[model samples]
Target: MAKQAKNHAHRRMTHQRQVISDCLKTLNHPTVDEIQTCVIRTAPTINKATIYRTMNRMVEDGEVIRIVGDDGAFHYDATLDAHYHMLCEECGALSDVDMPVLPQIDQYFPPDSDFRLTGHDVIFRGICSKCRAKKAGRNRAETGQN
Candidate 1:
């Protein structure tokens, strides 16, 4: 029984490594289905259940970061660096926002408070520059102004 358990764990770890490798290659944060698709190309025998289980484990272990997109779907990213996500409201585009960590904000809650500060995920939602420019152009055209 112990040997069986060991083999199972080994297989899971192997699949997880492949999943993480595929995730790193993806530039954009992809959903579980997308990750599974990528893994399938390299590992034809890997099933969706294994992919999902491995991904969830990776997220829990902090090997991968999970972001809940503006569309409410979970997306995975392998970048461990501290960063936030920006969602373009008009175009539904998601991009990384590189900025300094604001650890000082946790002090505002008062150290004696019941709330224990751990971490934060900040997602800025606004129209991207391209979307704003497109809207402006449409407005000008509607107003009959070149």
Candidate 2:
């Protein structure tokens, strides 16, 4: 019976986990809070702890990548392809950067260096277009330009 239970557990994702995973896939680099909000829509009884545990497990299983924004919040992504991220400084929005990854940078080493680079994460930070537009509008209003 124990063996059967173990096998059953591995057979598929739990409904709660599936819901959380779906949220991760649908949302654009959502934080835990955002994920909870999305997950609650379908699984109203699921709580924050379960969501956090599931997301952390997914990260440990190498199924999701965690990105940190300027707000110091951990955002989750399900994209397994090689890519970088850009964070909006003004609104704390995060988006994927489709630029090619330069593997040569990982090969570069110091003289007689023993350091090794297993992987890399590069995050470019800037104000997103929406935030930029809002700032421009605020500036115009302040200056009475229109």
Candidate 3:
């Protein structure tokens, strides 16, 4: 009976991990609602509460990264890699910035201070190309410019 219980526990953990992993793999920087929706498609028995609990646990365990977008929504990322994010103000889109990570920069800050730097996240906020073009077209129409 003890062996059976252990196996059941292991299987439960594996399923939970798989659900979170599948959602992360399928979506990019998805919100909790998006994850719940995706997981429900595969495991209808899993509810929003379960997804929320599992995702929160995974974030606490450092298996996932939680980023707050400009719109104040939490986005989950499972890249486990060092990278930055770009947020579009007009469209509220979150995208990964593929820039190189500079460890020296972290060391350069407060060189004489006692603050230990673990890591950093840099987010660039601006209008995306689509929004910019739309604004430009509107301006041209108003000003009678081609």
lDDT of each: 0.78, 0.86, 0.86
RMSD (CA, Å), each prediction: 3.9, 2.7, 3.2
lDDT of 2 at 30: 95
Model 3 worst lDDT window (10 residues) = 102-111
TM-score of each: 0.71, 0.85, 0.79
CA deviation > 4 Å runs, candidate 1:
1-5, 90-92, 110-112, 128-146
Candidate 2, lDDT over the whole model: 0.86
How many backbone clashes can be found in candidate 1? 0
Estimate candidate 3's alpha-carbon lDDT, on a 0 to 1 scale: 0.86
Q: Supply the TM-score for candidate 3.
A: 0.79
Give the Cα error of residue 124 in candidate 1, in Å: 1.0
**Which ranges of candidate 3 are over 4 A from the true structure?**
1-6, 130-146
